[model samples]
Each structure stands twice: as C-alpha cells, then as structure tokens.
Target: MNQTYTIKEKTKQIFVLLIPILITQLGMFSMVFFNTIMSGKYNSSDLAGVAIGSSIWSPIFNGISGILLAVSPIAAQRFGEKKSNEVSAVVRHGIYLSVFIALAVIILGFFFLNPILNKMALPARVEKTAFDYLVGLSFGLLPLFIFNVLRSFIYALGKTRVVMVIMLMSLPVNFFLNYAFIFGKFGLPELGGAGAGFATSITYWIIMGMTWFIVKTQDPFSSYPVFANMREFSWEKCKEILQIGVPMGLSTFFETSMFAVVTILLSKYSVTTIAAYQSALNIVSFLYMIPISISTALTVLVGYEVGARHYKDAKQYSWLGVLLAILIATGTGVLVVIFRYQVAGLYSNETAVINLTANFLIFALFFQISDAIQATAQAALRGYKDVNLAFIMTLIAYWLICLPVGYLLAHFAGLGARGYWLGLTIGLLAAGIALSIRLIYIQKRKFTHIQVKEVV
Candidate 1:
C-alpha cells in the first residue's frame, strides 16, 4: 500500500509538471505554425521560402537552446541538494553563455549568408525570399537566447507555469503581428515571407521583456535572488556549463541538422515537394511536443532524486517517464493516422501538397514511437550527467547511418522525399534502442555500487 501510494503521488507530480511544459512547448511552436499556414495561403513560393528559412535557422536556434538547457539539470541538482545560492551563479553564467553564442550565430549568418544559399542552388525567387527572411529573423537571436536562459532557470526550479503563461501571452501577440506585417496592415508595407521573420523577431523581444518583468516581480523567484550575482563572472562555472552543454548542443545540432539537410535536399525537387514536406514535418513536430515535455520534466525529477542520493527513486523516475512517453505517443500516433488527411489539409489547400503530406503521415506514426523512447531515455541520461555518450550515438546514428541511407534512397533509388523519411525512421529506431540500453546499464551500475556499499 505504501509503495503504491508513493508511485501514485509521483505520477501525479510528473503530470503536474508535464502539462504546463507541454502547453509551453506547443505555444512556442505555434508561432512557426502560424507562419507556415499564413505563408502557405499567401503563396507557394513564399511557403517554400519559409520552409528553407526555418530549416536553416531552427537548428542553430535549437542548438543554442540545448546548450543553455544544461542549466536546468545543474540547477535542479543544486536545488535538490538545498544549495540555493549556487543556482544564482549558474543563471549568471548561463546568461554570459547565451550572449556569446547569439553573437557567434549572428556573425556566422552575416559571413556565410550568400555562399550557403548559392551552394543550395534553390529556385531564384525562393532563394531571394529565404535570404530576406533570414536577414529579418537574425535580429531576434539575442533576445531569443536570453529568453532561453531565463526559461531554463525558471523551469529547473519547477515553476513551469510562469513560463507557460508567458508563452501563452506571446501566441496572440505573434499572430496579430504576423497578420499586420505579412499583409501590409496598419500602414506597414507588405513584406511577404520576410514579414514572418520580422514579426517573429518582435514577438521574441516582447516575450523576453515580459519574462524579465515577471522574474523581477514574482515572489516565487525572490528567494534565489538570481540577479544578485549579475556582475560576478566565474570561469570555472562557465567551463562547467560548457562541459555539459557542448555535448548537449552537439546532440541537438546533429538531430536538427539531419532534418535541415533533408529539407535542403528536397529543395532541389520542386515547390510542391517542399511544401508537402513542410506540412507533414509540422504535424510530426506537434506530436513531438508531448514526449519532449515529459522528457524535460523527467530530467528535473531524475536530477533531483539523483542529487538527493536516492538512486533507486531516480531509476524509477526514468523508467516511468519512458513508459508515459511511449503510451502518449501510441495514442497520438493512432489519432494522427486516423485523421491524417484532415491534418494535412489544415496546412495547405493545394491537392498535390495535401495528398503527399497525408502519405508522409503514415511513416510518422511508426517513427513517433521510436522518437519518444529515444527522447525520454536521453533526458534520463542527462539527469545522470551521462551526456557525451548520447551525443556520440546520435552523431553516428543520424549522420553516419541515416543521412547516407536517406541520400542513397532519395537520389539513387528514386524514392524522393518518402525515402528520406524512411531513413529517419530507421535512425530513430537505432537511437531509441541504443539510448534505452545505456540508461539500463547506468541504472544497474549505480544499483551495484549501492549494494557494494551496503556490504562494506
């Protein structure tokens, strides 16, 4: 009875944390979704441009966000150990790290902008629109990175609701701004695809400002005094963050870059192909929010348990998270399969685009299971501070195996876009199996250590 009750309590806690994180993620992605839908309605070329711009920018942005995510587990562990003061130092260092990375991305964007586009050899119009979109979007990198730092800090402290509320507020603001700028409303000239970028940049700044205002005024964050050490910079702390974060960032880069590469490859086909791919990808990404949210909460929970030296509890949390993720994926995959056509139709009205997108959704069903398992297991491993192994595995699985297979099947075998997704399915399966095994091995090793200590 006692064990059952404890499990029930833990499950409830996970849900409480997971729900808000899930909503927050959906809110974040909605900005992109709105841009995609609005752009699709505006013009197919613009849609392709948005797709290309998103593929290029998202990986860079997400990679940096992943690096800052190291703050979450680190802060969670410290908080669990009752080392509250240390959390502030972590936040400060995280801010410095965010600034550095944002500047690096901006510099790279400026230098490589045209050369990279020329290499792709995209349709001249698509290429021009994508270039303009990226230029407008680049302005938001600083605020976006800073917002991520604050989000990681707050999420680690288990105050996810605050971030969720802020993200929710940004959704309408983003929509309104996109409508105004994209259509030449409110005395603004129509900028077509570039308008989406401008709206996104402005929305990010608003969200950042609102988030800062809340952190400054909120009672929940008063105890940490996160701003108290703003001027203090510690090399050791920065190094510590990078040690964990670099691998995490690389892991994210490897995965997102694989998709970006696929997008680039598809761009060689036609506007219709790219638009269909974008629509399907959007649906898959929406379903992905569930597992990713659960995984994030698991990271904090597992880290807290590990820091408290409750290895058994930590292991339980990890497995529970994986189980929950798979179950949720199973349900979502079923619904997506059932309503695949309807979902595709939501993104675009073109018959060719809708038909192709619907077909891709079938493959998405199988990969969803693999994706959930790998994501949750990776998060658990991060909680154990076992980060590098996953990164190496992902690099091997996605780059060495998946991308090569995808290219061969798409170009050589004449399977086209479908071939790339097939390759992704196989890669996700490999990653899921490898990461799950790693988590099991780590847990068993820790359990053995506890046994040896007990005997001694």
Candidate 2:
C-alpha cells in the first residue's frame, strides 16, 4: 500500500512556501510606504503626483509583468517533466521578451505621456509635476523589466527567500535615496517630485542589480540558458507567453486604472482630500501585501500540483491558501479599526487629513475579508493558467459593478469621498463572490472526474 502525506505535512509545506513570499511582499511594500511618506512630507501636491503618475504607468508595466507569469508555469511544467534544458530555455526566453516589452513601453510611454496626462484632467500643477515624475520614472523601466525576469526566475526555483533578501537590501537604499533627493540631504539638490522620481529610478536599478547578482552567485538551481549569441528568439514561445500574460496584465491595468480614474475625479475636490485619500490608500495598500503574497504562493503551488496531476491536492492547496488569506486579512482589519487614528497620524499632521483618512480606513477595514478572498482566488486562477477568466471577472466587478455604484453613491447620493470607499467595497465583494465560485466549480468538476476514473 502507498502511504499518503498527512494534513500536517501539507500545511507545513504550504506555510513554508508562503513565508518567504510574505516576507518579500512586506519588504517591497515597506519601500513603497517609505516613498509615500517622503512625498507627503515634501508636500501634499507631491504625494498626489506620485499617485497620479503611478496610476498612469502602473497599468502598462502590469501588462508586461503579466508576461512573466508564463515563466513560472512553463518552468514548473518543464521542471515536473524533468526537462532541465527546456526549463532554462523558458527562463531565457522570458528575460528576452521582458526586455523587449519594457523597451516598447518606455518608447511608447514617452510619446503618449502628454496625451494620457491631458486626458486625465489633472490640475495644472499636478499635471506638470506628474509629467516630469513619470518621464524621470521612465528611466527605471528597463531595470523593472530586468528585475521581473530575475524575480520570476527565483520564484520558479522555489528560492523565494532570495526575493526577501534582495528587497531587504533595497529598503535602506530606497530610504536613503528618497531622503537625499527629497530634502537635499548630504549635498543632494532638492528635486521635489522630480527628486522623488530620480530616487525611485535609482532604487529600481539597485534592486535589479542585486537580484541579478543573486541569480548568478547564490542560486545554483537556475536554468539561465546560454542563448546570447547563437539562439534565435522563438515566436511560438513568445505567443504562448503573450496569451497568458496579456490577460493578466490587462486585469491589473484595469483594476489600477479604476483607482486612477477615481483619483482624477477626486482631484475636483480640495488637495487636502486627495492627500487624505492617498494616505489612507497607502496604508491599505501595505496591508494588502499580505494577501498578494498568499496569492503568489498559491499561483506557484497550484501550478506545480496541476502539472504533477495532483488534482485533489491542487484543490486542497488552493482553498487552504484562501482560508489563510482571510484569517490574515481579518486580523489586519480588526487592528486597523482599533488604531485608525494612530495610523493616520503617522502619515500627516493635519486634523482634516487625519479625520478623512481615518474614515476611509474604517471603510477599508469592512472590505478586508472580500479583498483577501478575491485576491487569493485570482491567484489560484492564475495558477490554473486561466488568466483570461480572471481578467473578465475583474472587468465586470470593477467597471460594471464597482465604478457605477461608486459614481452613484458619490455623485447622486452625496457621499463624497465616503461614496468612493463604499463603491470599492461593493466591487471587491462582487469580485470575491465571482472568483470564489469560479474556483469552486473548477475544483469540483476536476475532482469529480478524477473520482469517476478511479471508480472505473
């Protein structure tokens, strides 16, 4: 008789798998928070610039990042099949494609920057500042591209801890760069929003360099193929990456663009409101890193299990990941509700900013459960290589359901900023339900078919 792996062993493996990812997420989120705080301190307008600027570019980068998802599955499938050289080829192709994608975005972004900003209807100052920030931020695009390739490679090797280490190294460097540029500390000239942009650009290169170094030195299990001179790029592999990646990228872009659209709408309000909204958002965004980590881990595990033909285990691992995400999100929600004021105070000293941020933070707490559920489910879907479905679900939830409700609540109902928060809640709730149902149906069907075959 064959022995079955115990539940404890499974749980332990999943936890161990997730821990490194969680640490990496936290470290990266901390760097983001540092930038936000630095911008806010320089001026509220600067903070708004970061928000708007990031919104404009995030979607494009997200689409590129989506392509990297192909690496994990392709690498994992090959790893499972014991096709070692093919795994290296996949990673090599992923890096080459990422560089091309990044360069394309950079070139196009420069040409499109003015038009996009104009369409956004940003205030004169905010628009100009954001334009400069984005253009300067564009310098880091190549680095971001390289980092994604290397990071995905690390993830495929299951040495996610390296990601944690690299991010850890980046935190201090990011802070020091922000400090130097923001305040002209240590003889650095004050660059304001432009300074922030330059600081971030430097940080991106540092991260990429460090991650690449790790790939070369520390990780002996990597499949970095030698295609530098002799190998021609494969359109077939590129097409496969695009098929999975384009949808995933569009999903992130759509969701992020929704927030950006709302931010533009909010710009019609006082700058104080935008500042408050950004602060609250920054805090919530940090908390969200937890679920994002779980999702990343789920994607890896689900892909591995599916490739290995462990139908039951795939279903089990995916659900367990969701459960774990919910528990973490719930605990975070409770803590946020309890210390909403203190958390707000950390970002700004203004009474109005603090009050408005605290209120939104309360609303943010209400949606944490659904947020966790949806994020984990989406990750599981990605793991299943069902990227297109995930894209559609996000579209319907945000564009059809959330945006409409938020507009109605904010404009028609006079909820102001509160209306936007309420709208976000509705959208997240819809996404959570839809994604969960999708996962459950897929799991049940797969499991039933497996059981039926066993009986036969």
Candidate 3:
C-alpha cells in the first residue's frame, strides 16, 4: 500500500511539473510553427529557405544550450544538499559559459557559414534566401543562450511554471512580429522569409528580459540569489561544467545534426521534398515535447534524489520516467497517424507537400516511441552524472550506425526521402535499446552495493 501511494504521489508530481514544461516547450515551438506557416504562405521556396537556415543554426544553438544544461542537474544536486551559495556560483559559471559559447558560435558563423552553404550547391535562389535568413537569425544567438541559462536555473529549482507563463506570453508577440515583418505590415520592411529570422531574434530578447526580471524579482527564486558575486570568475568551476556538459552538447549535436544532414541531403532532390520533409519533421518535433518535458523534470527529480543519496528513489524515477514517456508517445503517435492528413494540411495547402508529409507521418509514428524512450533514459543518466557513457552510446548509434545506414539506403539503394527516414527509425531504436540496458545495469549495480553494505 505504501509503495502504491509512493507511485501515485510521484506520478502526480511528474504531471505537475510535466504539464507546465510541456506548455513551455510547445510555446517555444510555436515560434517555429509561425515561422514555417508564414514562410510557407509566402512561397514554398521561402519555406524551404527558412527550413534550411534553421537546420544550420539549430544544432549550433541547441548544442551549446545542451552544454549549459549541465547547470540544471548540478544546481539541482546542490540545491538538494541545501547549498544555496554553491548553486548561485554554479549558475554564474553557466552564464559565463553561455557567453563564451555565444561568441564561439558567432565566430564560426562568420568564418564557416558561407563556405558551408557554397559547398551544399543549392539552387541560387534558395541559397541566397537561406543565407540572408541565417544572417538575420544570428543576431539572437547570445540572447538565446542567456535565456537558456536562466531557464536551466529556474527549472532546477522547480519553478517551472514561471518559465512556462513567460514562454506562453511570448507566443502572440512572436506571431505578430513574424506576420508584420514577413509581409511588411504597418510600414515594416517586406523582408520575406528572412523577416521571420528578425522577428524571432527580437522576441528572444524580450523573453530573456522577462526571465531575468522574474528571477530577480520573484519570491521563489529570491533565496537562491543568482546575481550574487556576478563578477566572480572560476576556471575550475567552468571546467567542471564542461567536463559533463561538453559530452552532452556533442551528443545533442550528433542527434540533431543527423536530421539536419537529412535535410541537406533531401535538398539535393527538390523543394517539394524538402518542404514535405520539414513539415513532417516539425510535427514530430512538436509532439516530442511531451516526452522531452517529462525527461527534463525527471532529470531534476532524479538529480535531487541522487544528491540526497536516495539511490533507490533515483532508480525508480528513471524507470517511471521511461514508462510515462512511452505511454504518452504511444497516444500521441496514434493521434498523429489518425489525423496525419489534417496535420499536414495545417502546415501548407500544396497537394504534393501535403501528400508527402502525410506519408512521412507513418514513419514518424514508429520512431516517436523510440525517440521518447531514448530521451528519457538519457535524461536519467545525466541526473546520475553518468553522462560520458551516454554520449559514447549516442555517437555509436547515430553517427556510426544510423547515418551510414541512412546514407546507403537513401543514395545507394535509391529509396530517397522515405529511406532516410527509415534509417532514422532504426537509429533511434538502437539508441533506445542501448540506453535502457545501460540504465538497468547502473541501477542493478548500485542496488547490489546497497544490499551488501546493509548486510555488512
């Protein structure tokens, strides 16, 4: 009966955290949704242009943000140990790291963006628009990283609802800006597809400002004091963060870049294929927030338990998170398969794009489950501060296994877009199985140690 009660309590707590985080995730994606829709209305080429530009930038941005996410688990552990001062110092280091990474991205963009695009050998029009879009989008890189740091801090403290409200409030503002700038409404310049980039950059600053204001002014976060000793620099602390975070960043880069590579590969075909691919990919990414949110909350919860030395509870959290993610993914997958046509139509009215997107959803249905499981399991590992092995496993699964198979099937076998997606499904399945096995192994090893220590 107590075990049943504990499960029920944990489920309720998970939902409480998961719902807000899910909404925040969706709200953040709404900006992309608006961008895709607005650009699609302008033209398919414009939509494809924005898609290409986003593909280029997202991995860079998300990769660095993933590195900074080290703050959450680390801070959560410290917070669980009631080390408020150390939490603040760790967050300061996160901010410093974010600044360093933001500069690195800007430098890489200036040196590499053009050469990379040139190498892609895209059509002249698509190439020009995508280049412009990325140029406009680059302005937001710093603010986006800063916002992520603030978000990681708040989330680790379990004040997720604050970030959720801020993100939700930004959606309408983002949409209006996207609409005005893209169409040149109210005397704004008609920047076409590139305008979405400008709008997004501006909205990011607003969200960052709001997040900062909340952290500074709110009661829930007041005790933690993020700004205390704001000027202090700690190379040792930075190295500690990088030790764990770099692997995570690389792992995320490998996974996201796989999709980006697929996008670039698809570009060799036709605009319709890329558009259809982007549309289907966008839907799956949006629905993926459900599991991703749960994974994130589980990270904090498990990290806290681990820090408090409640290893059994941490193990329970890991398995429970995986179970919940699979359940949610199953339901979401069924819904997408059922309404695949309508979902595709929502992105665009083009018959070719819609039909292709609907077909892609079939593959999406299978992989969504795998994606959820892998995501949750990885998050749990991060909570345990066992990040390096997960990164190695991801590298093997995505780069060594998935990408090679995907390329062969898509190019050599001539399966085209469908074949690439099938490769993605296989890769995700491999990663999911591998990570689950790792999690169980770690849990059992720890459990055995605990049992023997008790006997001793």
Candidate 4:
C-alpha cells in the first residue's frame, strides 16, 4: 500500500511541476510562433530572412540559457538541503555571470553571424533583414539571460506556476507588438521582417521586467533576498557553475547547432525549400515544449532527490519523467500526422511551402520520440552532476554522426532538406540510447557507494 501510494504521489508531483513548466514552455515558444507566422505572412523573402536570423539566434541563445540553467539544479539541490542562504548566494552570482556572458555574446562572440550570411550569397534584402533582426534581438540578450537565471531559481523553488502565469501574460503583449511593428500599426514603423526581431526584443524585456518585479514583491520569493547584502564576486561559485554549465551548454549547442547548420546549408536551395523547412521545423519546435518542459521539471525533481540523498527516489523520478515524455510524444505524433497539412498552412499560404512541409511532418514525428527520450535523459544526468561525459557523447552524435551524415546525404545523396531531418533523427536516437546507459551507470554507482557505506 505504501509503495503504491508513493508512486502515485511522485506521479502527482511530476505532473504538478510538469504542467506549469509545460505551459510556460508553450508560452515562451508562442512568441517565436508569432514571429514566424507574422514574418511568413509578409512574404517568402521576409520569412526566409527571419528564418536565417532565428536559425543563427536560437542555438546560441539556447546555449547560453543552458549554461544559466546550472542555476536550476544547483538551486534545487540547495533548496532540497534547506540551505536557503546558499540558494540566495547562487542566484546572486548567477546574475553576475549572466551579465558577463550576455556581453560576450553581444560583443565578442557570435561573429559568425555576419560572415556566414554574407558568404551564403542571399538576396540583398533578405541579408539586410537578417542583420536587422539580429540587431534587435541583441537588445534583449542581457535581460533575457538574467530572466532565465531568475526563472531557474523560481522553478527550483517549485513555483513553476508563477513562471507559467508570467509567460502566459506575455503572449498578448508579444502578439500586439508583433502586429504593430510588422505592419506599421499603432505608430510603429513597418520594418518588415526586422519588426519581428524588434517585437521579440521588446517582449523579452517586458517579461523580464515583470518577472523581476514579482520576485521582488512576492512572499516566498521575497524572503530569499536575492539582491540583499550581495556578497563580493566569488570565483569559486562562478567556477563551480562553469564546471557544470559549460559542458551542459555545449551539449545543447551541439544539438541545436546541428539544426542551425542544416538550415544554413539549405539556404542555397530554392527559397521555397528553406522556407518549407522552417515551417515544418516551427510546428515541431512548438510541440517540442512538451518534452523540453518535462526535461526541465525532471532536472529540478531529480536534483532535489539527489541532494536529499534519496537515491532510489531520484532513479524513480528519472524513469518516470522519461516515460511521461514519451507517452505524451506518442499522442502528439498521431495528431501531427493527422493535421500536418492544416498545420503547415498556418505558416504560409504558399502552396509549395505547405505541400513540402506536410511531407516533412512525418520525419518530425520521429524527432519527438528521440528528442523526448534524449532530452529527459540528459536532464536527469544533469541532476546527477554528471555532465562532462554526457557532453562528449552528444558531440559525437551531433558533430561526428549528424552533421557529417547530413552534409553527405544532402549534397551527395540528393536528399535536399529531407536529408538533414534524417540525420537529426539518427543523432537523437543515438543520444537517447547513450544517455540512458550513462544514467543507469550513475544510478548503480551511487547505490553501490551507499551500500558500501552501510557495510562499513
């Protein structure tokens, strides 16, 4: 009876955390959904421009956010250990690091953006709009990184609902600004595709502001004093975060950059092909919120259990999170297969783009399954603080397997855009399998250590 109750209780806890994180994930992606939708409506060139811009931005932005996500597991474990002061300290240093990293991204790094697009030999207007969109996106980089830090801190506290609500609230604001700036409505300039980037920047700042205010004023959050009596810069804390974060960030960057590079490579194809790729990629990305959110929740839950020294519970949470993610992906995959055409139409009225994307949705179905397994598995590993090896595995999957195979297939095999999607599928499957094995090893090693201690 107690075992049954515990399973039920853990399932309930996962769902409770999962739902808000899911909605919050949806809300975050909806902003981009709006961006793609609005840009596609303007024209194919505009859409392609925005697509390239987003392709460049998404992977790097996510990489940095992944780094900042160190806050989630670290803060979660601290919270589980009831070290509130330590939690406060983590948040402080996190904010400092976020600032430094944001500046690096804005100034020193990502120089690839300019030269790569220039070498692509895109139409002048498309190239110009891509740069404009990136310029606008740069404005929000600082705030967005800080907001991610705060969001991780909040999630670690099991206040997933709070971030969900804030993200949901930002949607309409994002939509209105997107509309205004895209079409010259409400005194906003018609910057064409560039407007989408500007809208995203403004929306990010607004959401960040909103989150900052709530964290400052809210009850449980207010008690932590994230900003109060801030300690001097601590290299130890920053290095600890970097040790975990740099590898975690690279893993995600490797995965996302696979897609980014694929898109860039596809740019030489007809505008319709690249545009269709983005259309298909967009809907699947929106659906991706499910597994990714589950992954986020698992990181927090597993981190908490590990910190509390509930080794068995941590293992249970890992498997449960992966199971829930796969089950949800299965259901959604069926629906995507059913409504692929209709969903494709939502991106653009172009018949060619819609038809190509409909066919691509079949491959995207496979993406959900592999991504569900791999993403949650990776998150669980993060909970174990076992990130470096996991990073190497993904590097092998994405760089060695996915990228080379994709380039060869697309160029040599005449598979075009479809080739890259196939490569992604293989890479994700390999990653899922490898990460699962890693998790099993970590679980057994921990249990063995525990048993040895008991024997002693």
Give per-model CA RMSD: 3.7, 3.9, 3.7, 3.8
lDDT per residue for candidate 4 within 1-456, as digits (tens), equals 011127788888888888999888778777877988898898788888988788778888889888999999998889877898888889888999999998887875357678888887899989988988888888888889999999999998888999989898889998999899888898878988899888989988998899999888997888898988765778898888889899999888887877777877888999999889988887888788889988998999888877767777889889999999999998998899899899899988999999999989998899779989999999999988889999999899888888888778878899878888888888888989999999999999765444111332
| Backbone clashes under 3 angstroms, per model | 0, 0, 0, 0
lDDT of 2 by residue, 237-330 (tens): 7777778778877887787788878887888888889999988887887788888878877787777666656667777878888999899898
Q: Comparing 3 and 4 by lDDT, which wins?
A: 4
What is the C-alpha lDDT profile of model 3 across 102-148, one tens digit per residue? 88888988999899989978887778779888888888878888899
Q: Which scores greater on TM-score, model 3 or model 4?
A: 3
Q: Name model 1 segments beyond 4 Å from true.
A: 1-5, 39-46, 122-125, 264-278, 344-359, 406-419, 447-456
On TM-score, the stronger of 2 and 3 is 3
The local distance difference test score of model 4 is: 0.86
Per-residue alpha-carbon lDDT of model 1 for 295-382, expressed as tens digits?
9899988887777666777788899999999999999999998998899999898999998999999989888998899899999998
CA deviation > 4 Å runs, candidate 2: 1-4, 34-52, 117-129, 179-192, 217-219, 223-230, 268-276, 348-356, 413-416, 446-456
Compute the lDDT of residue 169 as modeled in candidate 1: 84
Best-fitting candidate, measured by lDDT? 4
Lowest lDDT sum, 10 consecutive residues, model 3, at 447-456
Q: Model 1 Cα displacement at 343 (Å)? A: 3.6
TM-score of candidate 4 against the unseen true structure: 0.89
Full-model lDDT for every candidate: 0.85, 0.78, 0.86, 0.86
